[model samples]
Target chain A: MACETDKALLQENIEEYIKDDNKVVTCKWLSLMHSIDINVAKRALHIFVHHQRNKGGNDDINVTFFVAGLGKSKDGDLMHKCAVVPETELEVVKRSLATVTSCHIFSVQKAKLKDYTPLYMTDYEVIKDNIDKCNRFSSIKCPWVSLKSGLSASKSAQQDVVKVVLSENKGHAFSNKTETGNDSPGSKTRALAKKVEPKGSITSMFASASKKDGGGNESSKPVQKTDAASKIKATKKKGGVTAFFEKKGDSPLKQKDVLLGKDSKKMDASSERFESNVTNEKKQDPKRKKKQAADADEEAPDKKRRRRIKTDLFDSSDDEDVEAGEPEEPEEEIEEMEQFEVLDKGIEEEHKMTEEEQKEEVDDSSLTKSAVVGKKRKRTKKVVSKHYEDEEGFMVTKKETVWESETDEEDEASVNKQEKKSHQSNTSEDMGKLATKNTKAKADPKGKAAAKKNSSPQKSKQTSLMSFFKKK
Target chain B: MFEARLVQGSLWKKLLDSIKDLLNEAIFDCSSTGITLQAMDSSHVSLVSISMNSDGFDTYRCDRNLSMGIHLPSLSKIMKCAGNDDIITMKATDDADTVSLVFESPNNEKVSDYEMKLIDLDTEHLGIPETEYSCVVKMPSAEFQRICRDLSQLGDSVVIACTKEGVKFSASGELGTGNIKLCQSASTDKEEESVVVDMNEAVCLTFALRYLNFFAKATPLSTQVQLSMSKDVPLVVEYKISELGFLRFYLAPKIEDNDGDN
Candidate 1:
């Protein structure tokens, strides 16, 4: 492959090329034209330049050398510099640089070259023509340049395909796990086991053994285990089971509704119509029912006592009328009977009072009834008068007249029998009164009282101070 | 082996002081032409680029292309030990883990050498293209630094508006609003002190005063600071390091969510 004649011919061609004093010739351009190595071209150029200098042609020929070395930067840091300088200034340029790494004849020209741009352009044209084979004869080697070839490109494509397939499989498995885990813990564990069976055969072997022991028992045991595990996990959380119960306890109205259903049925048969009316109202406005149910639950005991006293007042008034008609008593006794009727009207008027005021009136009426029953001979008439402004801004006066009967020993037992009969009749009248009065008072001060009650309890139900700190 | 000697040693100290607060560690790429460093701040809101040509050095030599990762604060500390007139020399091997710095007193009575460990840093070189800005303003660096420092007292951000008449910097905050304007001066004998505005169009942009204040630390490096601005592009603040090279800062403008207030 080494030919001496071919080298001589390349030398002859270079000699002919340099014969023109106006043209500049570079090693890269010489190497490309002759199809030779760059280092050989550089040596050829050096030998030709020396031959010209030896022939006393130095004054006509000009040579440029490529120098690369380190030089001091402005900020005291060392920097590398590479330059092409003419032969006349080579020594001066070399001294300016701290060190010279490489220095050789880059190009030879007859005319003194002021700009190196034409030389670079000439070399760039040759390099551009043979770009694919340009680095074949060069000494420097870069690994990445070779790695960007056809074989590595195919290899990288295969790796990308493998990565995409792996990512898709991972995504599919992730989506499957989330979908199966949404419904229940027992099903979630089973789904996980099913997914892991392909990856780990040991788990599947255990599952098969458990299935063979008892087919149905296998499912039941895991369900119970998961239930216990979830319970334990819930307790391990910050709020624990108490938080779970507190959430349910927040709505006490639901619990009262359940209790009220049973209590109203067992306690009083007279209030059955009243309870039905309340249920109808609850169905009409569900939002207001919570407040009303809370009010009814709190006032349930007081309301029962007030109902019983109203019945007693009606019964005593009926007995007084019977005695007044049969005995033809004096004017005072007739006046006492009239007062008994007025007291019954007063008991009816008590319904319009606020809950606290109604509670006080119920206590007073019960006390008077019991005291009058104990002292039958001392017939006294007590008149109770109350004045208050109604919702319509009108001052209404309520007069309660309490009359005691002068009863003989024999008449007392018969009076009790007639009183029991009147008790039955008064309950029917009481039901009619509650149906009319409660329906009308739905938008009155009763609603305001329910709102005030609702707000007070909500203010008291603040989060516990301990909840602010995390449990260890 | 590589070595570089500089007579003005205090220039290195000032360069370190200007960039130490912005960059904790940076990679210096040394090539045949010069040494250049480009790095973004930790928040990625601003970038600093430094370039110094080898022609500017008194004596420089490098055998191969090398990249050295250096901690700026430690380098600053080493620089502080040298006198302002001391001659500084930097030396390193081709494949070395540490760089050596030698400080020689001008009178040759004292000399001290320090070795600093080099770190391996993963760096991505961002390509900043050459753009034609709408406005370019040249003014005394001290005046620019003073304006930045004063505006920072009023607001977190300063709005820079450049018009045909003058360049204005305004800042509004809880305390109050402050405005400073610099009109282009006529030709003067003292060129460095004169303000010059070369504008093709008007541009108004907002920038964080905190970062502008940090960039102002380079005021001692040069007499004049050059500012280039365009709509939606980062503002470029450049300070020429004498006849050596330039240190430039690229600051991303603040995006206004409510454009009604300008």
Candidate 2:
């Protein structure tokens, strides 16, 4: 009756059921009774008939076979026919057909069958009773059918209950049936449903089932209820497209914060974390780290010192905040904050580097004004050098040249110097005035001084743009 | 030594274009008979098999069997440089580290040669056994491509159902479900355009549309595409490459979650 067929039990059941002289045993009847394959039942019937004939006393057993074949009709079209014939007439029936596709024992009896009406009626009754279990012993199994025990009776009862409870809700019954079928596999189909059934229906079913039991851990009931509630919430969240858009919309705001330099404290924390992560990565490849360290020492010691000081300040502040908040807050919140801080600092540093490069270009143009002078016209070449760390942590130096012209060289030189002086004065004043208001403003002067020191050696060589174009 | 030449150089270009998107690198096995390539996509969900007979080439010669592992995108880039009417001749010596390709104009006025380094690739050759499919459908390659393209807009996976009556392609997603059914065409006058379904039993399987779209790139190589399918087996999509041989793609079906249940 289960998935596997018991051959010994099947043979015994066939022998016992055919002991009655008036009772006839059909292959379909035996298959439905023992839940064995139809072909296996037919083979068992043949063996039983053969064994009785071999007894050598009174051979009264009669066997009939089911024959199906493709035969031509009068119109020349292929006509498929299936008929039940006695064992003696099987060969004659086979000779009359074009091709015998299948020939299996149809039934076993004591007397030869005059009419097949009783056999059909009895087999129909058996099939009608076991219609739901007809596919139980089939080779191809349906997952929804096999998942439940006492499938036929219980499923009908549950369907009746669903109908009474949710008479107006069509999807409720369908979804409930799928839910009770298989949990995970059916969930995919449920997720694909266009109109999701209300959560109340699912929970109500659970509530009703629990009430029917009437006795369990009362304390555990509310916990299970809350679990179901949260699961409902999760499914609701997963079903919406707005949640995805909301997440995408939040990233640009964070980028804007980094660009505006509004959260320096957060930026410092993040940069510290970024440095730690970089050091961790460098530890994996020490040779690259050593080379980068050597390059850093040769290129910008002052910037390194500034970075160290800022990191130390950030570490001390972070320690104080952790000591203050450790007792009340969880560690996960702190970790999330650290991650956000690191991301903010990386973006902020990139933006700041671009701004510094632009300011350096402006400084180069200003310095070139003091070098070039001519009687009629003057042309000045400005070299712009950019320094950045590559992914391998090596310093990459890129240089570009810009040519400028002025009719009155001396006048332009004086004006450029004054403009540079005013810019420097304004920055220095802003640094001192807004020292407490903005930490970023305080770092500007140091960056400008470093840029000037790096660019001082290139001032002597300046060329006019007109020199290249002159047709001399 | 091994050498082969093709009068229509554009065939190689189209072949490379068809496979370059699916494979990053492939190994070409060349023998006295022909050249064949078998490779799986990066995801390993789909496999591509190509064969060309030596008789199809204008001239062919081989002293020994050779396996050349070449980067496909790079080869495609080089193939793009050849003119449509240029005669392409590929030559390589025994135990050679590089292969040379010469492109000669029809009038013998201009000639260009390019050499590419071969890589030593460790490859495991999979032995594919021939199988009898329950259902085999032959339809216009363009129509198949159109169906795959249109269904991809509705879902990520397409369910192909082949019955005695006809074959149906359907896909369901957040937007809606779309079904396209093709009945056996009654008229066989234009054999290339007729839709034929030869089936012993009905089989329905689901496949990823993204890979089907990739396989459909061979539409220009042949007018007809053959789709062979069976239950619990990979589907084969084949396109005959004119007088050359065929390009076949085998895609594993998307196993439903319930299929794993005992």
On lDDT, the leading prediction is: 1
Per-residue lDDT tens digits for candidate 2, residues B124-202, read 5556667899999999999999999999887777889999889999987656779999999948789999999999999
Task: Please write out the lDDT profile of model 1 over residues B175-254, one tens digit for every residue.
Answer: 67789999988476898988899999999888888899999999999999999999877889999988679999988887
lDDT of 1 at A218: 17
- Cα lDDT tens digits for candidate 2, A273-330: 4343433232222432343454443333232232332343344334323323112232
Top-TM-score candidate index: 2
> For candidate 2 chain B, which ten residues in a row score worst on lDDT?
B253-262
Candidate 2 docking class: incorrect
Where does candidate 2 clash, by residue pair?
A270-A341, A379-A464
User: Model 1, which residues run further than 4 Å from truth?
Assistant: A1-472, B258-262
Per-residue accuracy of model 1 over A1-472 as CA lDDT, tens digit each: 3577776776677667778435678987787777777789899898888777787734487799988787654444454666789988899889988989888889987767879888867766665555445545555444544423432332243343445456446645664666543434444444454544442332233334332322111121122222221222222222334334323332342333243454222222222222323232222224223433545544432323333443444454343443432332443333333222223222221233344433333333333433543433433343433333444545555453433233422232222211111122234545455334322332233344344423321122212212221222
